[model samples]
Target: MQQISINTPALLFPAITLLMLAYTNRFLALATLIRNLHTKYKQGQEDRNLLRQQIKNLRRRLLLIKQMQASGITSFFCCVLCMLFFYIGYEGWAYGIFGLSLGFLLLSLVLSLNEIYISTKALEIELKDME
Candidate 1:
């Protein structure tokens, strides 16, 4: 097995940061969409069934995004902790923490993929409504 080092975990820092930024952008865009939907629903500008379906989809997507962010943040934290452990000469602990960090990052990516699938499904729903 390749020996773990502080640099190994540090490499994830930039990638994780970028992922978090992307996730935050996704969240902000979703929030804007939700607000727009709310306004349209309030003004009765859209069909009730379509709006309700969209709202349901948005709720699920929102929850998924929240989970993705949490897992990503946890991964980032674990990476930092891993580095700290290595710096302090706890090679064993550092290796374990690094593994955990990778696991969390994998989970976050999976959640992001699921959210993307759901997002596309939502778009399909809208298109179907139009048809």
Candidate 2:
């Protein structure tokens, strides 16, 4: 059972992909918004209030993405170490690796949710905004 499970990294693939996609989407949106803001700012026509809010939102989303990516990388490293230990006959280390992976997984999920929340709130404000 352990060998069968260990042989498959498939379980993490979808989750990793989803997190990557979410992070990319947030970054792309941030890029576009930043470009627009820069243009408006240069034109001296920027809506200060809205620009302030947008910048704040972008900062938040970026922070979440950074956290997710950092955690993901650490988790991957732990997985590699786990596999090495397993191959070396140090089976006890698997438990530690399992715990690390689980923690990172939860961290990524929480970060994803946080990004979603920030995105939704920003959208809501932008939609109702008259400027």
lDDT scores for all predictions?
0.95, 0.74
**TM values, all candidates:** 0.98, 0.82
lDDT of 2 at 52: 87
Please give, for residues 1-131, the per-residue lDDT of candidate 1 as tens digits. Answer: 78868899999999999999999999999999999988887898999888888988999999999999999999999999999999999998998999999999999999999999999999999899879
lDDT of 2 at 122: 87
Per-residue error at 12 for model 1, in Å?
A: 0.2
Question: Residue by residue across 16-71, what tens digits does model 2's lDDT show?
Answer: 66766767777787778778878988998867888888889888887887887778
Model 2 spans with C-alpha error above 4 angstroms:
1-5, 8-10
Model 2 residue 65 CA deviation (Å) reads 1.1
User: How many clashing residue pairs are found in candidate 2?
Assistant: 0
